[model samples]
Target: MVFSNNDEGLINKKLPKELLLRIFSFLDIVTLCRCAQISKAWNILALDGSNWQRIDLFNFQTDVEGRVVENISKRCGGFLRKLSLRGCIGVGDSSLKTFAQNCRNIEHLNLNGCTKITDSTCYSLSRFCSKLKHLDLTSCVSITNSSLKGISEGCRHLEYLNLSWCDQITKDGVEALVRGCRGLRALLLRGCTQLEDEALKHIQNYCHELVSLNLQSCSRVTDDGVVQLCRGCPRLQALCLSGCGSLTDASLTALALNCPRLQILEAARCSHLTDAGFTLLARNCHDLEKMDLEECILITDRTLTQLSIHCPKLQALVSQLLVVDLPLRDERCPATLPHYRRNLLSGRVSSIILGFRGLLVGLTWEVENLRVTVFVFGCEPNTGTQVLTQIHGQPVE
Candidate 1:
């Protein structure tokens, strides 16, 4: 029953269309919906062409259909810059065609779970909207190489594309994308098991601007494939090779040597990697901030010490070091002895304390089952933990 400034409604008609549009822009989606019910004038302004620039119909996915999107697109009058239909399962090729026809100015479109649509939508985009910048086809199994070819031929301005879990796609599809979209920056091919070295090789050959690549669960991508990928794409920053069981020292070596801007690397479940692979990474990749080495059974204390000495900014170390059998030669022993000691007494890894080499000289880090605190070198008895703790700052436990 209530509305914005009831007295101002009387003079709202006198306001210029541009000013009215600007004023309507300040209202949130909920407020605009309420205003639409107030009167005909308010309704017209509420659904104005300028007001529909970014339509996020993801929340209304369960309730809305193609007609809703069509209506919004018509109201937008080709100014819909960003549209996200994240889980609108009912949307199909016809709905996308209608959207493409009306919202020609749309630059970013997210149809992550729109399963009913196929390559027809891609063809529609190629025919109608050529300037699309971002597209998410996650889990859209209906699409094939034809759609990728269509996108490659038309969407030349495409920058970010997510084909994650689209197992139907092959090397040819991505090859087309690489050839068409030169400025492509971020590409996610997670779970694209059908693709092998050929896909990455082609991308490295053409898509020079690529920065972040996620090939998690890509079983066929061997160390040779990754070596080639790293050799070409030098500016790569984030790479996720989770579930890539075949990766070894060769892949890590290539990444360390080539990708100077590398920051995040998720190598979880890469069971073949050992201490040598990580040691090479630490020695070369000094800028590494986060690294996931979970399930790497062969790694020990040397790798952790290398990371601590090399990567000054290393923040996260996703490793199974603490949970595994606490071996004396393990990397966690030297790098995080204080943590292990704390956890041994308490439930969680308390702070063991370490600064001067692997052995902190004070804590009883298990010597033949008996607790024997060893004081080696100039470290007196009580000052060992204090001196090191002061140097390393507060306790990490």
Candidate 2:
């Protein structure tokens, strides 16, 4: 287009090539498509290799087809680092294979909920994307032990692998991964229904560098499996045995003695766990920060007291206390209050924001025919001169 001195086009052309490309780089993939259609200069700037470091197809329309994926992959070439194709059901094994072949430098790949992909796609990914480190295959139901063969052989650098709800994989595949990918740090096998003690034993035997292990909903994993696994994985920082109801105090006792580095442990719905096991954990695992023991009927206030005293790092506790719904009624019960140690700035401790004194009150509620009293401790749960005495499922006025 012809332009005078005041023309916007004339002014934009006067800008340096570096400045033009830098401006184009800020545009997202969809916006870049529009930029490419504007003019020849903008088209060249949009396709520049630096502008395509990350391609997340989840940002685009649901109908992103195989040709679109192939074109994007070709444009990216070897520059792609992070590619998220989460829920991109229109594209499958063929398009993903094309991507894996071109983007060799890819590190993080999120293919969560891509139902059309099978073991062949995983094989292609392993053969081509050798630099792959993080992979999320959550809900890829077609994925089986055959996929592990590809991952085990080539994806040696893989550290974080999430196979959550990929129910097709079994003990054989899991065991192969543990043995082959010794560098595996975080492996999530939640809802792999066929997995049992056999896979846990394999993990215990081989996966030593593991820090986070999620065996939640693996109903077959019992206390024996946990005992064996904890004995091997001493560096475990986070462990989720949620819904593993078969586990007893034996598992907790083993973890307390073995996993001193354990910080976060979630045993939600583990009805068999008792105070004896949790107390052992609190006294031993000084680095413990968060613990979930909901539905563990045997766990009482004693464990809470022990955690408050022994675990200095404990910030969040999910014991039965968090679930206790104090019904609104006129009932008085003497609560044996735990002396909560507060950070002492002066000789006396105060919850008051200002340097003044405040009134202290106690709370009493009935649960299971037993009246329990809770002496209010910690920062006052009030907002702008309001007091909240009892909080049920919903907030109180």
Candidate 3:
């Protein structure tokens, strides 16, 4: 393994440029920058555009300036396919305009948390980057419908878009987006409170290929909108209705009747849902894997029993409750007692939660193939809240 001076100098001189680039490819941005300062030949190998195809500057987001991005874009040019500038708050439209012009072949771009960017960036991207597939503009609050319009006019190949926390978005913007990006498979619209029934209607009309739709906190949408959406977008597999207070059992019934392939249903804080709605959902959506029923006060033991009986694929059920009665319980056990209380105290369970609030406690355990997690909340305790979790009968921390 010992290298003599002749052997050491000969290896670098004899190695092919392709092999040197291959070795440089394994180095990260900081190391490559250091390598560029070693010597002239190392500088050429380090700065070669082919070795900088996919760069993630998230670790140095605070230090990454506009000039750094511009230089990287110029260096990589058409060879760059993915670039993530997530949390780079200093990045603005001018730098991204240069980036779009240079990196025309880029497919996946993560601009999440880039608060300084605006519609101009989207305009630049649409004008150049037609191969764009996944774009995350999460929390880019400054851009409004103009950005959506720009994206709709171009970027027809977009598949996954996350506009979470973009409060300026309205129905018109959503309509324009769905009309153009008809192939959208996953769209996250969380906290876009301006969106109403019309936005969902637009999604139902054009985005039939949608598999995951997160409409969390879009409280303006009603059951009628959800019904129409469910009927139109039957390919939906994961849906989030959390904080959509206007939704009722009618929405659940619509999902059960039309979206049978539903796998993940996050209905947390949807207070109107009752056992009757969940019973119907369980019977039809047999492939259901995870369900979040937290804060759903109306659902009782009947809903749990129905799910345990019908939805065999159910893996996780999150609810806030003091009691549950599943059909799998022995008939000899008292009906007044919860189905898992005996096993929970006997240490036969795989997992356990000892505390949540003094008034109500949540115990989660895995039995055979079923994994249930119940989370309950009550008034703040005088002694403060403490959570102790145990896995395989051993306390964790």
Candidate 4:
């Protein structure tokens, strides 16, 4: 490209090499690609490894082929820190082999929805990319225990992993993972149906640093599995047992007795859970914030009242088809009601989804030092079945 007397490509000629690279770092991937086409000098500056440190190819997932990933890996090389190739169906093990070899310093990699890749891709990652920390392999159906073995062999610094919907994963794979990667803090095994109680045992024994675990839909896990898990992982804060039909109240009892720092608990669809389990939990775990008791048929208003009285830090409570009861009388209401109502009025309790068969009928009363405003949702105005919907000091319609 010829520059006129007024232009003279003065900017590129006058600027230092460091300043030119610094300027190119501000451009996005599309703009960088466009800039690379201007001239030889601009092409070298635009394709510099430092400028391509973090690349997210999710926008071009459908159009991106394996060659694009390989070329990017080569260009970025040791300078690349993060790369996301999510939903790129065309990316296979062969391209990933080159990527892992070239970009060995890559820290965070997302291969989610890349269906064409198999265990060979994991093998490449394990051979290189030793500094890998976070990985999202969600919906990678082709992955099996062999892939877990590869990840366990390497990726020791891995802290967060999402293996959601990977159907082939079993107890053996989980054991191998936790045995090697004991530093794992969060593991999402949602929808991995093949996992049984043995896998939980392995996680309890090996992964002691685990704080967050999602066992959603792992139907084979019984109360015994949860007991072992809670006994071992005392640092557990967030636990999801949604759709695990085999779990009973014993699991909740185990959690309450062991995990004192328990904050978020999701036991939706666990039919055997009663108010007895939750009453004990609320008394023991005062830091509880979010509770999802949807589809728990056995629990009544007793559970709701107990949680409101004891768990002062409670924010979101999702109890669909359950009655909400908050006694207003001076003798009946506990001293903690004032503190709970204060937290509610101060906007700490942002969401309280209590579903009952009724319409909102306003009611306000003074119980001890607290002036509480309750929105009672009852089937009929005359009926005595009053369900407390909110406690925001002002009437909620």
Candidate with best TM-score = 3
Q: For all candidates, what are the clash counts?
A: 7, 0, 0, 0
Q: Distance from true position, residue 124, model 4, in Å?
A: 0.8
Minimal lDDT window, size 10, model 3: 348-357
What order do you get sorting by lDDT, best first? 3, 4, 1, 2
lDDT of 3 by residue, 23-85 (tens): 999999889999999777789999999989999999999998899899999999999999999
Better of 1 and 3 by TM-score: 3
**Which structure is stronger by lDDT: 3 or 4?**
3
Model 1 lDDT per residue over 170-288, tens place: 99998998898988999999999898989999988987888999999999999888988898889898999999898888999999899878888999899888889888888888888
lDDT scores of the candidates, listed in order: 0.77, 0.75, 0.82, 0.82
Q: Sort the candidates on TM-score, descending order.
A: 3, 1, 4, 2
lDDT of 4: 0.82
Which scores greater on TM-score, model 2 or model 3? 3
For all predictions, the C-alpha RMSD in Å is: 7.4, 8.1, 8.7, 8.9
> What stretches of model 2 exceed 4 Å from their correct place?
1-12, 321-387, 390-397
**Segments in model 1 whose C-alpha atoms lie over 4 Å from true places:** 1-15, 322-397
* Estimated TM-score for each candidate: 0.81, 0.80, 0.83, 0.81
- Superior by lDDT: candidate 2 or candidate 3: 3
lDDT by residue (44-89, candidate 4, tens digit) is: 9999999999999999999999999999988899999999999999
Q: State the weakest 10-residue window (summed lDDT) of model 4.
A: 347-356
Q: Of 1 and 2, which scores higher on TM-score?
A: 1
- Which prediction has the highest lDDT against the true structure? 3
